[model samples]
Target: MSRLAVSVCLAALVLAAGPAFAQTATPQTPNIGGFPDSPAIPAPTNATYPGVIRYEVDATDLDRHIVSVRQVIPVTGSRITLLYPKYIYGNHADTGPIQLIAGLTVMANGQSVDWRRDAVDPYAFHIDIPAGATELEVSFQWLTQSDNSNWRVVMTQRMLNLQWEKALLYPAGYVSTGITFAPSIRLPEGWQYGVSLETTSFENGLATFAPTDLYTLADSPMFAGLHYRRVEIDPEGDDVYINMVADEAANLAATDEQIGYYENLITQADRLFGSRHFDRYDFLLGLTNQMGGIGLEHHRSSENTHAPTFFTSWAASAGSRALLPHEYVHSWNGKFMRPADELTPNYNVPTENSLLWVYEGQTEYWGDVLSARTGLHTKAQALVLLADRAAFYQNQPGRRWRNLQDVNNHNLLGYRVPGQWTSWMRGTGDYYDEAALIWLDVDTLIREQSGDRRSLDDFARTFFSPEGTDGDWSPRGYTFDDVVAALNTVEPYDWSTFLRTRLDADGPDATAPLDGIERGGYRLTYVEEPNADEKAVSRNWGSDFRWSLGFSLAGPNNRIAAIQWDGPIYRAGIGAGWDLIAVGDRVASAEVLREAVTAAKGGSDPIRLILRNGQRIRTVELAYHDGLRYLRLERIEGTRDRIGDILTARRR
Candidate 1:
């Protein structure tokens, strides 16, 4: 037999030895590669504890209907503890006490031990260990119903709950936390497995990997499936793993071409940053059945989902590529150098760290700039994106309802009161939009002041210097004042007031500073309607509009039980207990109804509705608006100098 085949055969024998030894065996040393001179993995100085010891989870697909997960977390030392968050961060609402972890089973040194749930908070769980316990093992099952939107094992349908399959096992503080994950799936015999972790070992149908440390582990997200292609672009110089997971029926040749595009984008980003931080950084691409896109950032990896055809269309591909850059940049902005308190304490608690504008907004700005800089997007395309964001915020009715500080303080208070209003209210719009503009302003300021010798990159490197002592950067969380202070370091002129007036408050002169862009040989104009060629390439879902009456009606098996008055239905002569069988010759399907509504065209046409009251069938036409509302654009002739000069200014 070949030497490589022999090695694989021996490894298989070791894995087949069973769980008792696997559970007790000491962890193997990490094989650090790539940079020989890189510093050793930093250890926790203040605390003498093992950081994220070991994690094992098994989630079985029960009858192809429901999946249940049983996890065992082993920690170092005689005392073992684990935390189950009452609510995951970014979710903002309590998961409600249903005991997701039911009937705790604890074993210490092959003997069962009694344990109690000590403390419960929105973010963590605390478990105790008895005396003389050398090793600890915790086993609990989480029931996942097939139709349960509240809990999900793989990808969640809700956008806000994207990272639902997350668990944090902290052997220490930020210094260490272990995560355990298992996708609910049934694998075919001899199927190959691909993951993003630095280590890959499979035993008893479970894959395991101990990341570099807590930080790197938290940053690496895992995706498991049979249909995927693993491409390693620069394995020797910079370790980049791309796990492109798609539907089995997808076009493999086209997928390869798209992967090449992504590989180039990531390589360029690394070049811009000047350093590769992680030993193994990965991108987990989950292909969905329909049209939608989302990207979540982990410490060393990112979870990205999009349709396969996204690469076929110029507009769609450009937008998806733009999203990739923003999420990848988070490895620095949102991961390594985070708001210290926000990292440890609850994120919902309000703070004055207006720097999210810098984090989220500056990142948003860079997404476009980097795309254009790398020749992935044209200058005109980038400008259109910026204009779209700006116009969306400018047209909102709630732009004057709140300030940026107030929005930051109440960002987590749910969408209706603080959340949704904060997102949609344009008083300044989300920081992403305003921050992009602010970055442009700062870039202009730096260029003008330093004769184009310094730009926002200087500010970024100075503030987010990985080599600097943590305290030298923002420690107690950065405020508006801190940002202004950082800006003054480069400009050295009292430019703080300029930022506050333009960004924090609405002023007539807020956009005046950008006028110099025209003088610098660029033109700016907002376009609403697409030209003939543009419309030809765009996807249209046809024009058929429908409106919901203000009332909510519910029934079992399509039979009406109660009617909610004050709903659009009640005003439209539809009463409670009226059975709704059709909405214009089509039976209603919850799935298809929403799709039909969003794709409907806007016009003053009445919707045809059929309802059954007792044995009588009543038909009515509901009045609805069906017109397309869009932001228009046009390029100005011979106005490049006027607009370019404004765009090149230091401050508005």
Candidate 2:
């Protein structure tokens, strides 16, 4: 439905239900838009009154970027507190998916109900029920996002992803798990959908799902499209399914060899962990040029999206091939074993997320490792990735002021800050990439300390799969002390100091990379031409030599991204926001910058740069010279081939 049509529907409801004056007016300003204080009530209530919710989604308006949602919530009291959940799981902020919802109204007993927003808990809306009302029907319009411009996407005539939490409301004061839901969706006439939710029946373009709890209901998202293909990636019938939907039929055709890599992935993961958490799993993928890309993890499935040509142009998309593998590993690391502070019973309550270094960072470490083990990317590609990450952080000027721990704490806001002068102007979170390097050090330290009898793989199976639970895929929360205690079980060390020192280090300290790389029997070096990994990354997004030069070159005119704090360029007083007019006395183009660096040949002679920063034109010379260098992994050849041991795939 078009925006006009949505408005028409909303206006019709207003006219039919009651006059505009009937709405219960909100008298006060909202304070921070969520429950301000911790709840005085205890969790789960010990008494399980099964709360139920149902949604009828109309996707006929997908072309107009609209989803008509009619929701019904059963209430058991004269006064009910209805909450549009904030602080949703997965996203570590109290501001959840509330922004995506529009055109909302609650009605009961054929009368327009009056609702008031709670001043303290802004996400909570207080609605008064009629004397004999059994249920309240809430209707709204959801705009499918096309971009961040209006925060909407009309993916394609073919594909759509449904995030249920953004559409429904529930009774307040109860755990999300304590409530039950029966979700029914109506898609486009010929469109098919994939979800972990079991099917009850499908008729007249409507598909109703088997009843489940709120936690499980929200955990299972749906991917639907006109073009669909389902492949059983594992012979073990209930193990895994790869459901791929695309914009076109040709984009959906994947070769057997290409699919075999993922099959091998399932086998390798099972052997490494020695257990399964969920009864079944799904990899829900959406391939479309019409929609913005996505990668969100759930306990039983992952919502993955990429370019329409993610498979056809494998070499070009090789950089993102590990996206599937990364989210898959989360089923073990994040979904199974979360940080204790982050494991809240409901989304409305604020969650403490200081331990993302272990939760997301260690998961990042295993993600890179598993990508190599599963043949999603070659072992050489893995080395290049780590080197790229280390080199990337080494050039990040923000590390001087902030530490890795702070990055985790401020991730929600830090992620969107642009890279115009990233190294200097802002301190972005480095938990994922930088934390991968940190966890790699932890792995190497374990290997070196234990004389190869144990590795991080043991840490994985031990920490992720706790004994006695016997494959139950429930949230097993842990604290920092639990992490340190687990590390002690692997190999005793002063882990507290070891981690704190690394986290507190200021700016471009190369010790962790140098020590970790050497310990793994390899060293970081550079080459003239870009490697396969570098070429792929640079092709997608521009590349630079920030590791050595302290600033990245981007844009069509080769503009400065940021100056590394006291880096080769920063020392020369050339900074970010400066546009390069010429390099080597030639007009600066994409290739001109590279030719200038390559011509210098590590010579002391300064490479001249003509920079224009808002009408101030100046000629500057970069004093230090290192020819165009790309990061590569080189074997130390003598000590021990621990790098090889780490990359080897596990066998049954």
Candidate 3:
């Protein structure tokens, strides 16, 4: 029925029944319904945009940390909309910093054209084209972050990282791949830069890149610095370059042995995946303490940052060495073979992350495996790292309510916020580590079911690197059913039930899935001292008392860095961010706290701690005493060492 006819009939029926129904109840306060939702911004379509967008950025203003931008967008309609990039791909969130764009102006045909932001979608700007106007001139300034307190400090005194999405706007109503962009940039004179885009021309400090689709342009970022060096790590196969940039020249000193480890990384990855995706890969490494750390993955390249002494002080930077391998594996897992829901056509569309357990989880597993295979960490260090991860999930209390599958949505819910109640609320990116353990379970299960003939390596080759479709970096989306089918292809079994039990189970009985550790012929054990990996990475980060006193203290003030969810410290009513004033009678120090913990062990005495929370000072007594516990993995006797076997170099 038509809307008017249906409404008339419904109103008549309501009046007919009102007299009878009203006699039984008293009149209630009237409630007003909400207005209809504002009209949706234009949905993206496959139609191509009319003309290429011209985008240029002047990033030489280091002192002010500003990126001046000019974009010329061709138009075909009288009224058009432009959208700032949101729902960024790598970040998997609506994290576009639109507030940073300032002083935006649009002009057409030598006259200013008025523009208004959409009332519903603030990321969109609507403007009317003047009569006979062929294009619109848009200008804005992107205020780059100056401090590392919350956001990345992209522009430092000696270098800058230019992400295109932060500096340009795109036309709505078309897919990102259907729009083209000719991007160019101007850097300070004498600064060298590295990017994935093919440079067409360079004059003075300006460089113009070849025209590319908006998708690729947004994915490619530039790293310019006072000191730059590009070295080819994979010369035997496809060219893979590591573009190293640093605040000072001496920080670029990468020894030959250290570089060889990276070369072995490529060789090991080739053996695992059995195919290459990108034609050429670029590893953009920024060795700096000036810029905030990043480990974002891209289709053809990855953006990464580490300490300035990452190479010069090799052993000290062991914790960060896995970053490169992790991002490198994403080219095959996240970028090429992607989850169907996460493969959106444009940046504005929301992504469903149900399959992130496989997308990011397996990548996390392989990153660490490859790191060990390439000698980035010794086998002992690798085992220690594994024990640390296993122990973390064992102590995680949030799993009682939040399952592994639900943790996948954490990128959207919390982004990067590390809540004070970590073990209960769950920290950001728990899927990365917890899912890695689940994959380990899957790997060990496959080995056991197939009688050692097949493992996840076979599944990776069958699912991600399918034959006759290699050397192609184009995305291929897959569903959850596809994952099960591929696993069945490797070894026919009830894969669905296995994955669901680990992914969906909850309540108090839902401990972390440790079948993988036992099946891999290893057991998680505790020791009085931490292993090599923990000791190496704890240089600046303070003491670890997680296994003993249930909290950790850091910084010179002895403030609690983290507290276990249901541990002794939590039961004693102590929360994170409280500064320790003294332990018993002695003034608080890391050593003094450890001595107290050790002395209280095997005795009936309680540990006394004086703490300051804000302006209030109180003495709290901890009724538990466990002395300095640390995690370690011990090999089970007379069983196959599948984890050790997996860590063995496949190429070697």
Instruction: Give candidate 2's whole-model lDDT.
Output: 0.76
| lDDT tens digits by residue: candidate 2, 1-652 | 3334545565565556655645753333323333333222233343454456787878778657788888788876777776777776776766555667778798898889987766445566777798899899999887667675744364567888887887777777778878888889988888888899999999888999988888898889999988999988985565699999998989987888889888988888887777878988999998887766778788899999889898888787777777888788888877888888888888787787788877777877877777788888787777777777766665566766666777676746633445555555443346667777788888888999999999888888888888865469988898888888888998999988888887777654523334777899988787778765667655632347666566777777677775667787788887667888888768986577777777777677888888899979988888757676666778887878787778788876
Task: Assess the local accuracy of residue 593 in candidate 2 as a C-alpha lDDT between 0 and 100.
Answer: 71
The 10 consecutive residues of candidate 3 with the worst lDDT sum are: 29-38
Q: What TM-scores do the predictions have?
A: 0.65, 0.88, 0.93
Error of 3 at 627 (Å): 1.6
Off by over 4 Å in 2: 1-51, 150-154, 412-416, 419-421, 424-429, 507-514, 532-542, 568-578, 602-605, 611-621
On TM-score, the stronger of 2 and 3 is 3
Clashes of 3: 0
Q: Which candidate gets the maximum TM-score versus the true structure?
A: 3
lDDT of 3 at 533: 63
lDDT of 3: 0.86
- For candidate 1, give the lDDT of residue 118: 34
Alpha carbon lDDT of each predicted model: 0.48, 0.76, 0.86
